[model samples]
Target chain A: MNYFSSDFKLGILGGGQLGKMLLAETRKFDIQTYVLDPSDEAPCKIACNHFVQGSLMDFETVYNFGKQVDVLTFEIELVNLEALEKLENEGKKVYPSPKTLKLIQNKGIQKEFYIQNNIPTAPFEKFESLENLKSKIQNLKLPFIWKCTEFGYDGTGVKVVRAISDLENLPNVECIAEEMIAFKNELAVIVVRNVSGEVKTYPVVEMEFHPEANQVEYVICPARIDDKIAQKAQEIALQVSKKFNHVGLLAVEMFQTQNDEILVNEVAPRPHNSGHHTIEASYTSQFENHLRATLNLPLGNCDSKVAGIMVNLVGEENFSGPVVYENIEKIMAINGVTPHIYGKKETRPFRKMGHVTIVNEDMKIARKIAEEVKNSIRVISTK
Target chain B: MNYFSSDFKLGILGGGQLGKMLLAETRKFDIQTYVLDPSDEAPCKIACNHFVQGSLMDFETVYNFGKQVDVLTFEIELVNLEALEKLENEGKKVYPSPKTLKLIQNKGIQKEFYIQNNIPTAPFEKFESLENLKSKIQNLKLPFIWKCTEFGYDGTGVKVVRAISDLENLPNVECIAEEMIAFKNELAVIVVRNVSGEVKTYPVVEMEFHPEANQVEYVICPARIDDKIAQKAQEIALQVSKKFNHVGLLAVEMFQTQNDEILVNEVAPRPHNSGHHTIEASYTSQFENHLRATLNLPLGNCDSKVAGIMVNLVGEENFSGPVVYENIEKIMAINGVTPHIYGKKETRPFRKMGHVTIVNEDMKIARKIAEEVKNSIRVISTK
Candidate 1:
């Protein structure tokens, strides 16, 4: 199809930062886009051709939006599966089909599929409810990780349980009791595929964690590891994508265990923050590649030209009003530092406000600059 | 100015392809923009916050639009300068200041500025008009290049007058006759500056010409020349920009003489076609930097992570109606090829419909892929 500068409309389900960045490429190709978001203050509220405020999980809202566009895609996975399935039955095109989302939406089912497909992952047991876990405590391992079967993300509802009291606080809902593997490093691999079955995987990246927060603080490309190990990680990621027959971008989070073994952690179906550095450092940005893949166009080069690091701008703990980026001007003086404020006017504690991308020919220098950027900028409340 | 997601407005004087691309950045930052253009079907018609249809050169139309925004900038040079000057006197900030535009709006005066600043350039003589040129032919050298003193671009109103007959078809207008110097290559250097007096230059880029049309068909990054020569070109461009006190992007087109000397050809004070490859190749795109510089924000990194080449997609000569990019899919199959189809649905011979940018670690490979893209896609009329 002639998608460029045409009357064709692409419907996007989410209107946050990922959708906002994707809109940049759509604007470049002059592709018409329609955005349906829950909030009127979405980052994509102004850039798209049409904007509708509606819940993505509402069957009528999503189905109606899908019917108007030539193609449909989403930047987030928390949407109504029934609506997407109905839209597909009605002959509307939805990338990364509803079936694929269902299989991976719950942590328990996703882990089972990996085991069935011979994909390496930390061993875990599924529970219908936290009450079931209590009844089976005598047979379970201590210091295990408990995660809700569904709707768990961004450090929410995932916790380490070393004692019986840990189970008392979690909701009595379907959950997964996962083995706490002694992994040396956290890694990620982003794979792009189309309906034609063509697939490509980006180089393995390592996530440096903050010792206290249990959150990713820095993502380093060309993971400073053995070349053979990196290859193993990429090979496994390709197998996962092939097994799932995924479309668009599938970012596989993995763990490199102490024995230099790769294990699947989780996956996000759209552009992941782990790949944000590509906007400044890669030959083709993940956001651009996501658009190309969803449209069934050929994939682009995903190699990095230099080393890159991303620093997320999460709101400070004490601030919860109108947002201001303090010391943002200081980082601009440093070479290769780029701050991308997501155009979010308000901020709450722990909410993502923006990100800073630092790239340099020398990987070491890039990482140093990234640390400085992280230290200088604060997304704090002004009121 | 709290431009991000605020009520502050920026008024643009033209809604062509350049303005369309600029509007993309403004919306990305959620800075409201108002565009003024004569054509309601302009490429920027759908993207700007407000698009007003009117003559860009009309004094009243231009002045009235300029008054609506906090600041004013333009993508096209052929606007009512008198109206802009009046707006500036009324305390409206105009980038590439009206004074700088005055020196550049006329080619004869621009050349004089170069000579006065001791900038190296090809020898040229200005004439009062084409009627007077014939009388002074005895004093001028043979086989000279003739160009209109004002409003000449894209090889328009320019010709090599090798003999008297070659000048017969020329209209009576003030023109400049320039000596055709032997040059090894054509090059360009983009220098970005802000009101804060900070300046930075992109690497010198070499433009390869199409032998038959004598037009730039591909622009190669890093110039493929000696490092010293490339640095010299950038330094010369910086000197020129400093002399003009030019704000925003100043693309200095240069000629690399056979003896490895860099000579200034002219300057364009906006996001220029010569810098388009930077969108994919540079760490920070030229459009984003243009917005930043205009806002007096800190500059961005201008280094290229990979070599890039851009091929123009001009309308086919035989087709002139609703536009279609025949075989666009074929071009997508070529690695590193990304097309930017400007939202121009109409087609006309020699009109720039869009461009394709190819980036790769190897310049040689990128150039080859660019050739495949140029050969595969045809900007034609569906009608």
Candidate 2:
């Protein structure tokens, strides 16, 4: 396609940190990029060749932005599917096609697809509304996981329904009741596929959750799990990508149950955070592979050069104003630690400000340093 | 200095490929940068927060640009020393200070500096003008190297004086007459120092020149030499950096004499081409270290993760117009091969278009792939 230093323009939706990181790969290859985001101060606003400040959810905005570029892709899934469908109809290339997104966007549909395809996943019941669920509460499982069918991200739009009172505060929205499977570890495998059907899987990564927040605090690549489990997770991720016929990065999140049975939980069809550590540790970072896949370029080697652990820097509690990374220098002093700040000037409690990647040949040392980095650096706001 | 996602603006004087690569680090850390270059289409124009189009050699332009940032550094050395000196006097921080630049800006002065510091170097005599050299040709050694005192870069302003006729076409400018020593290898070592005096040296790299053009064609990291030779080169590079009290990256180019003695050739006090492979091979890239050094942050790990080889992508002979990289896809399919296009839209003969870095665990395999990459990709132009 003559993408390098040529007239080929690659359009990216959602100019957040993922888009910012994607721009790094585009800049490395000298591929022209146009970014669309609602924020004027988006992290990607500086690196892209052109930036259109507009909503990615608005059909007209997304359509107009797509019209100016040769190829279209999105970092976030909230983009307007109708617009992308129309663009594809008109002969524009949209990776992870609208059809793939349609099947994966709704939790009810996603779980059904997994069961129909004979993929291993927790059984779930689809509910048209919270009222509908209440009417049939007597027959359903008492302690199932409730998740909204659409618009969920980063632990949002999800809840554990342990009892009747737990349903009182739930929104009356289309949702799914997923069987709560007792799991020992949450893992993710990123599968990359090019238009030519070339596919590759990155090493499995373990997601460690914050005990109270129930959110991922660290992502460790080459998860310290049995080799057999890792291989199973990779195979499952590949099956999901093949079933969807997706062309791009499909990050499949899975759970290892008490009996070591790997069950598919969900998927993010883009450069997922679980693969962020690859930037410093792997032969080919997930973001670069995503770009190469979207462009139909030959995929790169996905081997790890060293073990890597990523610690996300979320905003501190009770602090909301101009962002400041306290003790950033302290962590920089540690060997093999590289911090990537998102360039957001403001800070709100629990908001993602940046992430720090710790890499080392010794996994144990890398893990220890990751803990040190997490403890030493605080993302706070200055009034 | 609150450089991370703060108001601290790093002013870079030249917005060429070096500055573009440096901007990648600043963008990764969310550090604000202001770049100045004469061309509006410079590779760094879009990446930097602010870009000023002005001649870096003009004192007023450089002084005005320096006033806008917290600290000033130049990717290119041919900047106005008067402006930097003035800025330093007014309390602005300039790394690789004007004093150090003044000593190295002129080949005559740089050679003399080495001699006065008791450093090993080829003996040389400075001349007021080329005419002065002609008057003393009878007494001087034949087959010596002749170089202009000021503004020489990338094998330009240099010539071999084997006969009196070799001086006929030379410019009437201040020059140097250096006794040419028989050397088996041309090596380089990059030494990084922070403002607080912490220093580190990158692995030595071996440079192979184009036989006809006298320009470096390939740079192999961890030079294929005995451990003792590598240590000697690093020690000599450190001694040179200490003598200059240099801050930021000091790329010392050296010669390995036939008898295994190391001698200083020249140096560049910024991110250099020889260290370009570090971006893909080392734990800390030279660009990142340059940024850390200038910010007075602790140095990063200087160890290499894999062996790296870099091949310069120069414009194809007799081609001059819009640029195109032929068979780039063919080379990209190779494992561990990364091509960095410099975003230069036009192509002129012998002009540097970009560079490709090939990395592998085995140095022999990496070098073989580098050769394949060099032979496969052609930087040509469409008229």
lDDT of 1 by residue, B260-295 (tens): 988998898998888889888888778888888888
Tens-digit lDDT string for candidate 2 (A330-361): 99999999999999999887888899999999
True contacts kept of 2: 0.84
Which candidate tops TM-score? 2
Task: Please state every model's RMSD to the true fold in angstroms.
Answer: 2.5, 1.2
**Per-prediction TM-score, please?**
0.94, 0.99
Per-residue lDDT, model 2, residue B32, is 97
| Residue pairs in candidate 2 whose N, alpha carbon or C atoms collide under 3 angstroms | none
State in Å the error of residue A185, model 2.
Answer: 1.4
Worst 10 residues of 1 chain B by lDDT: B208-217
